[model samples]
Target chain A: MSILEATRLVKRFGPVTAVNDVSLTVGEGEVVALLGPNGAGKSTTLHMVLGLITPDSGSIVLFGQELARHRVEVLSRINFAASYVDLPGALRVHEVLDAFARMYAVRRPRERVAELVELFELGPLAKRKVMTLSSGQRTRVQLAKALLNRPRLLVLDEPTANLDPDAGDRIRGLLSALARQDGSAMLITSHNMREVERMCDRICFMSHGLIVASGSAKELAGHYGAEDLEEVFLKVARG
Target chain B: MTAATPPSAPQALTLPPLSLAARRMRIMGVVRRDFAALRRSPMRMFEVLFWPTVELLLWGFVTLFLQTQRVPFVVTFLLGAVLLWQVLQKASNEISIAFLEDIWSRNLLNVQVCPLSSVEYLLGLVLFSLGKVAFAVAVMAGLAFALYGFGVTGLGVGLVPFVGLLLVLGWSLGLVGIAAVLRFGENAQVIAWSLVFVVQPLAGIFYPISVLPAPLRTVAWFLPASHVFEGMRTVMAGGAVPWDRMAWAAALNAVYLAATLALFAGALRYARRHGRLSRFGD
Candidate 1:
């Protein structure tokens, strides 16, 4: 079963169309990467699917329920993490995680928190205020929050951005394991082609608010007669 | 080989789905989280206490000086006006800042994604503001009593209706302030602190509406807070509770609250449509 299905999603800001007629799905345990240049509607489509922004025209179905009609119910089973959004600075990392756990109505919140703490290796930073954490530390905390609900559908925007190589590899490994072991589906956006190729099951290329190309990394490289996914991305994005 | 060192294992844990009371808990959680933020920030705590006390002292001494001129009921009138006005200012300021805190911290998107409804979030801010109102009341009322011999209890049981109407009025204005901040972004943040004063002259806090010019009185009459102050002055004049004025104030406040809520709803819709929700503080 698909964890998310978005159809004909269109969002226009003033004279600009941020997303236009985009359709996609993320199946259970699948990881989908949305690749595009800046302002190419990748984040807009993600925001619409997350129900953070209302599409000018479209429908979003998550867990087989319509998002606009059942946002609260649907959102509880979903989680989102973005580099652009930060937790309240004054809250200790544990407090931030606990608050999200409570907000999501997670079962056994303290235990869930403890589990995430171990999973993300968030031991030493849990007591410190979120503002004090290094970018990599905060990214780990954000990832921990995304897993707090054991979300059925996780939406991550640039999940490994700004992290050192070691931290980045750990995050990629963690997300891959979540999909394999927990049957979680994820929709991720990242400019890092290697991460995309490594972590995503399929890649969708978008340009000017439209999904111009989509396939597995190998399939896309073959489609463009390119040597690798990065070359293919450059070719598609340039066009 | 027999002692391959028995493997150690962690405890098995079970997690049940949340009960129906989860909704109530979620609402309270928003309030708890903001207060948690406040507790972590010493500067915020100092500002919360400092403003009302300073305003009280400044206005208290001003009332004291005015009384030396033998102005009729100057002590009661000015002190009562300043004290009560603080309710409107503090309550509105607290509520708006509470909402702004989320946006300023770049946490709006995180909270919006949760199962918590906007109304639930709003209710949390209202409750938080009410708690702030309680704090301001204790500090300002104590200062008034000690410094100028002004007694808030002089309104007797009438204090309930007076405080309630003003609070609702302040909340209405606060909702408007928050909506503006959401609609206009961080640049509009000053509205949270200064919007109350824009209406202060019209509300006639320190003087009766009768003293205002004709055009201003007409404008003041339309403000629910004006009727609240009017009713308060009547009570201080040893008249009845001015239920008519109080009722007028309540009715007007209801309209204002409804309008502000509608405006907020519209603003949220606009923000979502424009993809502004996630871009706040950028």
Candidate 2:
């Protein structure tokens, strides 16, 4: 079953069309990657999906309900995280998670927060203010926040962008496990081709506000007559 | 690689509907986040308690000096005005500051993405402001009684309506400030702090509306705060509670509050359409 269905989404800012006629979907337990170069409208598309931006013309259905009509109800079942956004800097790690847990109406918030703290190895940093954490530690906290509700569909924008290699690899492994074990669908955007190849079930390449090609890693490489996904990305981005 | 076969249709996950109790919990969650910050930051705690005390002391002394000149106004009248004016200031300032804190911390987007509706989030801000206003008022009232022997309770039952009207007016102005920031971004943050002052003189915080020039008096007539302060003066002058003026203030507040709420909703729509919400802090 498709967890999200965004059809023919079009968003324009002034004279520039940021996302033009984009249609995308993510099925249950499937991890879909939206890969594009700068200004290719990936963020704009993700923003629309997250309900942070209103599309000029489009429709979004999440979990078999229209997002526009059932926004509050639908949104309660989904969550999002991004490297560019920060949690409250003054709040301690546990405080931030606990607050969000209550906001999401999670049952037994304290237990849920404790479980996430252990899952992310945040026990040592739980008492530290968010501003005091390193970039890698913050990333872990953010991911932990994203899972507070056990959202059926998770949207991530450069989830591992700020993490060190070891931390980044562990995050990828954990996210893949969540998709396979818990059947949580995800829509992610990343600039790292190898990370995309390892985690994403399918990749969609976008350029200049439009998706130019979409396939599995190997199929995209063959379709673009390139040796790998990185070369395919270069071909699509340059065109 | 070929496309993986799609999973067969599974049972849709059941999501609980948002009950009134649940919505209230979420609103309190917003308030809790703010209180947690205030508890951790000494400067924030000082801001809540210290500034109001200082303002009371400064104004209390000025009122005492004025009493020596045998002015027409009693010490209670002047000191009472100072105390009441702080309520209005705190109500408006705290609301705007609450919103701005989320923006500064880049947490606005995080909150917006959750199930909390815009109405819920706004109510949270208002409730949090009311809490802060209550604490500030208590502190100032106590200091006034101890240092100047002036009691806010001297206004009798009239104080209730007076403070209520001022609070509504403050909320209206605060919503306008929030709308301005939404439409114009952080550059318009000056509106949050300055808008209340713009209405301060017109509302006759320290003087009677009659003292204003003809043109300004006409403008002040429409302001609910002006009517509130005028009613307050009437009570302090040993007259009836001025129900007519209280009614006028309530009626005017209804209109202004409605208009500001609409303005805020429109500004939020504009932000969403333009994608400003995603890049608000940046």
lDDT of 2 by residue, A1-239 (tens): 89999999999999999999999989988899999999999999988988889999989999999988898888888889899999988889999998888788765668778877877889999999999999889989999889877888899999999998888988898888767867889999999899999999989998889988998999999998999999999889888
> What value does DockQ give for candidate 2?
0.49
lDDT of each: 0.83, 0.87
Which residue pairs in candidate 1 have backbone atoms (N, alpha carbon, C) closer than 3 angstroms, thus clashing? none
- Per-residue lDDT of model 1, residues A85-129, tens digit only: 888999998888887877776656677787788778788888999
Model 1 error, position B239 (Å)? 2.2
Model 2 stretches with alpha carbons more than 4 Å out: B1-15
What is the TM-score of candidate 1?
0.94
Query: Each prediction's DockQ?
Result: 0.44, 0.49
lDDT tens digits, residue span B196-275, model 2 = 88988999878999999999999999998888888888888888888889999899999999999999999999989999
Poorest lDDT segment (10 consecutive residues) of candidate 2 chain A: A103-112
The iRMS of the candidates, in order, is 6.7, 6.2
Best by TM-score: 2
The C-alpha TM-scores of every prediction are 0.94, 0.96
- Residue A115 lDDT in candidate 1: 73
Look at candidate 1 and tell me the lDDT of residue B87: 85
